[model samples]
Target: MTGGHSGRQAYTGVPRWLYALAVLAALVVVLPLAAMVARVNWANFIPLVTSAPALAALGLSLRTAAASTALCIVLGVPLAVVLARGRFPLLGLLRSLVLLPLVLPPVVGGIALLYTFGRQGLLGSTLEVLGLQIAFSTAAVVLAQTFVALPFLVVSLEGALRTGGQRYEAVAATLGASPGTVFRRVTLPLVLPGLASGAVLSFARSLGEFGATLTFAGSLQGVTRTLPLEIYLQRETDPDAAVALSLVLVAVAVAVVALAYRRPGGRGPDGKAGKQASGERPTTAAAPGGALT
Candidate 1:
């Protein structure tokens, strides 16, 4: 009666323990970040960042991450289209398998890659016949990064496909547009924001990949020592340098999240992608969806 009289019933119903748990979670994430920021010595921040080793790691990470992002795009786009548009048995299982890397321990993933693609492993003999080597090389770094980052791209694009729905694609088919043409013109353009966000998130994930690279690629300087690897190495020898490198990663992560969430084409915050170009009323996509009708 007291809560109703004061119009505070809603607030009263929220369990105090739940509020406490939320605060605890916030502190768990924030306190460590605050500590890292506090440890940063601004006086020599520029020097620490510009040091030769740091620069080499940064350059290598950027290179591998970019390559990995490209790989994710090439592979993820089609996979997303299939997953969204295809209605098959085990669809949910397939999605879970696609997203496994996101939840898998990075070390475990690295080990799996090592055994699956290692020189003495399953595909080793076949690769040797072709004069190709993957283990402990820059190629391996890119492979590892791609393995870990691909799920982000696929998940993002698939969600976009679902949200955009099959309505426009269906209409496009009705208009006599070839499947390829409709995909290129109507579907891709409509989901450009999803693609962009996915790419960015994939890039960020690749940039920070550490355990996989260390295990599969062996962390050679300028060859496989990504920024995160460098940060780990620096922590043992130089804590300040480690903090500086961490700051760079933290900054990059923030930028990536910002880019992914930003409104597309002057749309409001909630306007995920611009209105459907198909101009037909947007409808919830039914099962069996793809970019092409």
Candidate 2:
């Protein structure tokens, strides 16, 4: 009995070497971020963060990220719904295409954007005719951010839509609710968590966006330079200031992830109405043929 019990314990246990390897992997990932944060001098941190260029970059990063995140939600949510529920030929191909940005290098994405929007680009002449220029401007920064960050939102929303099911929506439809009404009243609430998480991730990604923004918007102080741009520029001339800015960006990213993982009911201004609609179940109705309706 003792031998059997010992064998069972061994089978259920993780090896010490495995735990050590896991810890080492975590340290490898975390040590660089810790070093960046630890290098910030408290005495100079406030002045560095408040410097003119830093302040401007911070504001621009926030504004552009917010705008991009808003755009992602407006455009991505509908696409996510279609991808999750709608039936169409080549749908699998379309889904893979949507996720291309996530896998593409940002530098490559930036170059592609330049080719699509630069002076000699397909639409560039038309835009110039209308007195609009996208290249090397604040508008370009927002566009770059939106392009790179949109896939994150779409993937998250699609996962939520698939897992959350459409039963409640069907019930609402049976009760004579319009399609839009069913979406707003049933579907939206079920997927709010995923949307919120996706938006936060997109915002964080936009805040740290570099290669694409640099290529499309150019690094101009108080115009298109964001916090990440400021950090890169400072690294060549002022390492201390670079560290300070890096710390700030890291802090913001950490805060966003932390808030996203917090308990849903306990909230301070960020919680939405949909978070309260957690009790509904997926529909179990069937067609006359007895298969999934």
Candidate 3:
């Protein structure tokens, strides 16, 4: 028996207010983006980008954002796995704490970082003993970006992990697969869509990071003046350049997110493929949770 249509079901009983709210939300973002796009000096866009300061800031932003995203992948994945599968008594609290950065004001986060890593701060003396400094440096920008962007990766991966559950992993273990093998062959593939989406988002967040970077890394050209900081400096003297830089950032972020997010909706080598590869009927795991006893 085939359903009449296997695609999107038309919304029939939706409230009109919901539509109104959706439009409002769309406008909230769209209006600002539209205004920025309209304000861009397209004719001078190339020169603006190639300008020494612009180039330096853009390059720094790209490198720091990439470094931050990479750091997120390294640290966030384990955190996600733990959050997804652990049965600790304080698991919920742990998750809340991990996600705290998302809600914390960026400036406050910068201040927190300053106190924790500043030359005269907590670990400062210890680092000083090692002759390594972190405060007001390129490293600080990377750290600030990583701190702010980590929650995005962790939350996305956790949700995907939860949605994926541990059924495939259990089956692999039952079939004599080692934990490492199951994780590499089963777990990683299952949550890849989320991973990609999260990475893109984190990169976007890192690219736009301003508050924390400014508070922690000070705007030193060629050292830590990332795109946003550069734009801020330019805005007062050259509004056109600022507008152009904003447009460039928005374009890149939009493109990256669109590409990564599009993968989830497509039938591809993603979560469902793992189940098919294992020749098992799908299980409704429902959440990243502790293994079945």
Model 1: per-residue Cα lDDT over 196-230, one tens digit each = 88998899899889998999999889888989999
Residue-wise lDDT of candidate 3 within 66-88, one digit each (tens)? Answer: 99999999999999999998897
- True-structure lDDT of candidate 3: 0.85
Instruction: Please list the residue runs of candidate 3 whose C-alpha ends up more than 4 Å from where it truly belongs after superposition.
Output: 1-17, 263-293
Q: How badly does each model clash, as a count of residue pairs?
A: 2, 1, 2
RMSD score of candidate 1 (Å): 6.2
Q: For candidate 2, give the lDDT of residue 20.
A: 94
lDDT of each: 0.85, 0.83, 0.85
Ordered list by TM-score, greatest first: 3, 2, 1
C-alpha displacement of 134 in model 2, angstroms? 1.1
TM-score of each candidate?
0.84, 0.85, 0.86
lDDT of 2: 0.83
Which residue pairs overlap in candidate 2's backbone? Answer: 167-283
Which one wins on TM-score? 3
